[model samples]
Target chain A: MTMPDSSASLPAAASASAPSTKLHAVAPTALPPGVRDLRLDFFRGLALLCIFIDHIPGNRIADYTIRVVGLSDASELFIFISGYAAGLVYMSAVAREGFLFSSLRVWRRVWQLYVAHLFLFVIFTAEVAWTSMKFDNPMYVEEMNIASFLSEPHIAILEALLLKFKPVYMDILPLYIVLLVFFPFALWLIRQSRLLALGLSIALYATARIYHLNLPAYPEDAEWYFNPLAWQLLFVIGAILGASTRTFANSGMDFPVPRNRWLLGAAIAYALFGFGMQFLWEHDLISRVFPHGSEAFIFPTDKTNLSGWRLSNLLALAYITAYFLRADSPMLRWRVFHPLIMCGQHSLNIFCLGVFLSFAGLIVLVEFSDSLAYQLLVNGTGIAIMIGAAALLAWYRAKERMPRKPAEGPAGGANVKSTALGGGSAE
Target chain B: MTIFHFSRRGSLGWRTAVMTVLLMAAFSPGADAAEATPPQDLAQFCAVPETVLPNGFLKHARDAYRAGKPLRIVAFGTSSSAGTGAASRADAYPARLQADLQERFTLPAEVINKSVGGQSARQMTSRLEDDVVSLEPSLVIWQTGTVDSVGNLQLEDFGRALSQGIEMLEKEGIDVILMNMQYSRRVELLVNYSPYVDMMNAVATQSGAALFDRIEMMRHWASSGRLDFDNMPRAERASRAAKLHECIALQLADMIEKAVRR
Candidate 1:
């Protein structure tokens, strides 16, 4: 590629060079790289869909669909995407505006996340309280004391400052904030050299795995539902991708097909080996090393440690996705894929609104049995509502971004309706 | 090529030998006999007593073990009487009491426990006539005060409701064993409970029903450090207490068993 022009659409030397160097022009018709990555969006949308299905009261399809697709529970997917998006967006900020700007941006996002968390915490607590009062059932109330709620204000303030809190049902935001706090450091290392970033990421992974140390998800006395120590690997991987994108894209890193039959045979054998390992793991063959039902061995397990099994599986999945479902593959461009893309596009708004609506919907239908039929009815309704919500959000965002007085299109003040229709890009 | 072949052959042979050894160990002759047997089932280890009574009030039940013509007793209370917090259901006081009755007397009796976790005396009382008395038990082990005290149930209401339960059981000639509340897991919390237990004891004495003072036994265990409530895990302590409770339960069961037999 030519040297980045100072007066180009992109800002400067560092900023323009990095993201562009990584993007491969497989399809001429594809959108610009910085504006949007369809693959990431598609994956995010797929995660949301899986999560919705899984959260439904008693859907039979959820179990089978999730296990097969590796998106059974969306906790890993959500957090993984969070890291990936942070790396993409924050890394860009660091490249353009330097460390201070990126650091401030991360802090701003943390504050926003904290506010969202607080709102959720209040809503859930109020709902539980309301339900308890109405039911007058002791069983309905779980660990509720007025002291608990009163204590929260002090803890939350401390958490906002220190980026730590005691593990509660609603304390994931603090963990994310803590992760993002290190973005400047991560970006600094990446800018210094790609090798340093790679080495640091590997070192972090090794430390977490070898020491088996888990940093506090919450305060000193709380259990983290999702251990950030293990989850950090996902973010690190994303950062590595963002940092070395230039090298990876230009280096002809594509997995070439085996010309010699022996290599293909070996690949098949190696795949079988992986499958064999899984089978043996399931049957408790290697009991001494890994006891069956070992906390680490569980599927999409409680993100405690980046267990070898899960990490291996993720690697295998990534390989398969890269080889078989590469960016410009016809499989990804199917008409059926549009819904998932929409969900991914409006993810933040959709997730927030969807989760709130789901809870409300469940409460409204509380008296109904958690039978198969009821699950179908609820899930069907949920899917429809999510679609409707996405459309509404998309429309609103589109309107907000557009100027009231439309500028003349290419034809000297001729009405430029085409840009509004098909050319509507990301905000 | 020759070196590679040799190395590969050696590794493969090693792998084969290891697998063979594992298979041999797993399926060797008389291996089944050599293996340790699984623990006996709950039913075999803990025999539920069976008995029949004239008016269908099961006798000799500390909690739900009755002996008579109908041979059934109902024990309805909170988690303690239900025999939770023990290593096994067989280790629960009610089961131990049933076994003791079986050994003491020749009466056949069955003890059915309808106790649930986190139940209060008032909740138990509300369901007394239906869940307990309706079972046509020859004996009713009416344990309530601990839950009532914890719940801060009105003492006047507690006494009246308990008396009402006793009256209902007695009308059917069902011997009622009024058990005092056991000591709390946290010894300091006992103060909140013991006075309520005493009130229950007073009602039992006034009504002329058999009294099993579990609070005294548990307090003794705790003070003597025999149960080690403070040092041990709550689960372990509960199990130790269950053994002590089982001993008292045995005596109560034997007394009822003899009366039923006579």
Candidate 2:
């Protein structure tokens, strides 16, 4: 019944270090030793694939994604993994380099994310515009909700630059950028006390739900699809776990998280309940028990505000995953699982690529046939391309680390080969 | 130097010839007419055929119009009918149609929008008793098939829901017009809407309901180059959409008027 202790299993090199105030003193290399966690990458990669499949709208394969069987979809998994990784990376930076330097580092990453979002925006708009013109169908632009940009370019451009006019599939990154901008404060609070940070996050989520607080969208008088106010709770919870693992490594003191049989049983029960409800809802059978208007106040699991049901379901799923799926599990070491690990390592790039690929998949589905073979072909090709891109990126990054010399090619290649085969630190 | 001289001269001559053809095509009268015709004014731009409506359609609306009583028509469907891309509720097809009908018949016409966003035919069917029939409308323009097709709902199930929904409305002696999915490149690329489109037409014919072939009409405008949705400048997209809605309304009005006169 014991919850898996991530800190207890850390490599000796990681646990040997105590909290230090010169984080940047250790030069920023491609990856720090003993920091890469396969578990994080594995789940993140899985989430990215689910997101890609789900975005195609009507693909038959989407039914197999986690959303059909669970209340919370890949969004929760993606954001949670991001937070966990951030906690590990930034908290270590804060402990080693001190708050000011680490905060700046976090902010720099935020800037990168913001730039990436804008880049995606430009490309997505162009894709829609070009396709619309080529096919002589204006509805593409409108369907993607970029009609505003077309109708009012000046104002639309200004609002988009401000991260206010996010179209479909483009909304998530803006929310992520906003969250990362505030990551430093969250990390600082967690460092002070994990419970304090968790408490504040829960309070904020509750307030948001009660008051309907959310950021506004530009062009459309609607709130952000993923309300940061509510979603920050999941992010903070992940950060706490991530930071606690690091804290245990530095101070040799574990965070007090009860891992009793009752807790495990409760988590299992809740997860089963969620799965059952999701199944019933999918079949349109749940209405028999919870008649439409009767459960109006309590029903219809809301994703935007991260409703109580969704949050609980996600927590249960997370608990089950943590309990069963250890980093050192033999199942994870299989050749088939390597792609997920690689994709997760290069998540940002793969995710961006996946978005475009999914759109292309959509186009193929619409223009071609909606037969099972076509759906499978489009989805399969898109995923294979994603996996291939990740592998190439991994190889390139590995190559960069090798010492340069014409005669040393075989030795350098061997080292890179071993790294890939061994599945060492993902970073 | 000799090779460079010949290549450069030949390239310049080819470029000049291509430019000359392009210029001629741009200035051609037919091309200019198609491109320049403002799509906003349907009466001016659209060559809508007379009697687009089926015979014996809109009997209730006609009777109401003749008796000088207010004609009630419900524009019922998913987001398009509810007006997702429209500038305003007034800019939606139903509103435009209401305005057109009222002006043409010289009688008060009320088009209630009972449409919901993101609802499939099945979901709409479930709400028919409350949303559509309960309103006691003389005519109901049901825009359907898009959501079901995009959602990948079973074709048989979709057909059943549509048939059931139409039966419920018609049983109340309401004239039903089945508006098929909008023709959009994005939608065309995303889902195979052909099956749903074909099924909708079959259902409309079998049920004796007027089929508003919106997709066909839109395709006509697009193919004729009367509306270049893809290449249209961003500044004019809103106006373009507004005009498209107005055009749909005008066509719908003509269909209703023709049916009533017959």
Best candidate, DockQ = 2
DockQ, per model, reads 0.02, 0.06
Worst 10 residues of 1 chain B by lDDT: B46-55
Q: After superposition on all CA atoms, how large is the RMSD of candidate 2?
A: 13.6
Clashes of 2: 4
Q: For candidate 2, write residues A50-111 as lDDT tens digits.
A: 98988875567988998875888899988887887788667766766799987887777778
Evaluated against the true structure, the overall lDDT of model 2 is 0.68
**Alpha-carbon TM-score of each model against the true structure:** 0.52, 0.61
Which digits, one per residue and each the tens of the lDDT, describe model 1 over residues A1-427?
0001111211122443333335444445543334445566677777777666654422455554433433113555555566656655565556666779767767776676666666655555444444333332221111122213334556644653454443222334555656676766776776676456656666776786677555653333323434566666666565555444323343222221212244334434545555555454333343335543342223322234545444444444443554455444556678788777778777766665555544544442332223344455556666777777777877886687566435543463223333332132111
Top TM-score prediction, candidate number: 2
